[model samples]
Target: MSTSDPRPALFDQWLPAEYRRRGDFTVLVVLVGIDTRSIELLSSTFMNVIGDETRWREVRQLFQSSETDWNGAAFFPVDSVIGPVPNDMARTQLRALEEKVRADRRVLNGGHFFDRKGRRLKVEEIVH
Candidate 1:
């Protein structure tokens, strides 16, 4: 949250309660360029960072889904302040991201959410 953008931190705050107490993390990666915009989600495997893998598995079993996990999540592609950006621009943006990642940048990290039982989840929730 040190950067000018606060969307990522906000997303981390809005995750379900189940994931938070356990320290699970989620993040979204968006490619923004001249004509293409694509979304790539990243997250830690539930068992990788969670201290209690057994308990985590049990909760997953009980919920039959991650619908109840409260892990802190974040958004990416800090640019592209709007929706459905052009695909070419997105591609360009992605290329830029690739370069940054290659340079060891901290651009992409964390886990993402998915639609389950009628709930729709996005990798990064864009905030303007």
Candidate 2:
């Protein structure tokens, strides 16, 4: 790994042998925003696969800064963090979760999704 690479260094140090040898894996996460009245789903993505430094930095800032707001809402992680799943499996899981969220009318802000190589993708591109 390059010293300035945006992928988290901790994963390089701690990832299991199988995944480490393969170099990258997909992890799906859901972020939620909460106010006095409601907790709404903010975004869902394989954020760990993002390799763009600027975008990664922005995401890191949001994840670390509690007061950051998105569309007048303060977002935070919910209980759902899935994977280190294989690439194909991650897509399947993401599709299923997107369906459930759509059905529930819970998605607030849209999300970023990426392939193992850090290429941005549309939900339709990934799911089908």
Each candidate's lDDT (Cα)? 0.34, 0.41
* Candidate 2 lDDT by residue in tens digits, 1-128: 34664433332232333244343445455544445454455665553442222343345455546543432221112222442455566667766775665565334233333222333322221232
Top candidate on lDDT is: 2
Model 1 vs. true fold: TM: 0.29
Off by over 4 Å in 2: 1-26, 47-59, 62-83, 101-128
Candidate 2 CA-lDDT value: 0.41
What's the TM-score of every candidate structure? 0.29, 0.33
Candidate with maximal TM-score: 2
Q: In candidate 2, residue 101 scores what lDDT?
A: 57
Q: Which digits, one per residue and each the tens of the lDDT, describe model 1 over residues 1-128?
A: 23663332332233433344435432223322111233423222211222223332343353345443433222232233343355566556555655654453234443232222212244333455
